[model samples]
Target: GFAGNTIPIVAGSALLALRALEEDTKANGKITITRGDNPWVDKIYTLMDKVDEFIPTPERDTDKSFLMAIEDVFSITGRGTVATGRVERGSVKVGETIELVGLGNTRTTTVTGLEMFQKTLDESVAGDNVGVLLRGVQKTDIERGMVIAKPGTITPHTKFESQVYVLKKEEGGRHTPFFCGYQPQFYVRTT
Candidate 1:
């Protein structure tokens, strides 16, 4: 079940990333950002550039988005979970089944298993990244920035609201201020 544990942690962390994307939507409505220091992870940061500065938290707060990182997954004999997540804001614990969605879509699955640092647990709360095990999902179905929630809480977003900032260099940042008449390419989490 190593795959099962690793998949959820990876998928769960990806979902958290989407929440950050939503936050960027609120600030500038549209924005353009360069990749981060990490090439693979930073690539996703570039995608947020089309959105605005303001980002929406999972709580729908207008505050800045929190960061979630996938550290690594380890296997323990007789244990049924993998370690994942680098908490940037809140703490994550065990025994909680969170919503697990995919990038580019909103449909989601549930995280049926979880664990903390090393102790076996049923769920993981917030803060601090944790390892986890999943039930009823496959490996290939997940990607970076997938959306995860606390059951029945993950909502589908076909067309939602956001803040977008135009790339300063793209249009010389000389467009009329407060103007809202453009539709740039959009990228978000999907089932």
Candidate 2:
């Protein structure tokens, strides 16, 4: 369930979650559901083969290709810059070189370290939220809405086409009509 104002966004996220669970179950032959006090806990538990017992391992591709959606950026005392985000595809490891793509430019940088929940990790795979310290890049060079990816794997683009639903018009009386060339601040991932 979602709040009143976030129904559409939550629905899309729920759909994706269900799809991922289905894929995991099919690949692993079993699924585990953690019990909680939430109303839907029992419903989810009933759909699984085990409760708090089965651990599904996700396959990680470490073929030198990866992508991360930047959620936050900060600077450390000794480290140059750090970007935190979930790995969207492939895997990244310490010492690997990557390209930062955003803000109408691309900069190449190396991964100096990786951390999650205040603990350092040698690598991070898809679906793992982690912070990566980067070398040769300043904090001002990165920002939210940027993407970090393996060098030569992605090309940054300024124009994109997407379908948007106008909620105001669907609620009740007519609002200001939107026309072509209308621009709005778009939020993606955690940005």
Q: Which candidate is the best by TM-score?
A: 2
Writing each residue's lDDT as its tens digit, candidate 1 over 7-119 gives 32211244545555556667669643335523434545544542333344444221323323334444445544343664344333344445554345543344445556566
What is the lDDT for 19 in model 1? 57
Clashes of each: 58, 0
Q: For residues 1-191, what per-residue lDDT tens digits would candidate 2 score against the true structure?
A: 74657322211244545665666579788655345533244445444534334436666554547999999999998777899998988898899999999786898889999999999999898888899999988888899999999999988878899888766866874588768997677777663
TM-score of 2: 0.64
Clashes of 1: 58
Worst 10-residue lDDT window, candidate 2: 6-15
Candidate 1 whole-model C-alpha lDDT, 0 to 1: 0.46
When summed lDDT is taken over every stretch of 10 residues in candidate 1, the lowest stretch is 60-69
Clashes of 2: 0
**Candidate 2: pairs in clash:** none
Q: List residue ranges in candidate 2 displaced over 4 A.
A: 1-50, 53-64, 168-176, 179-181
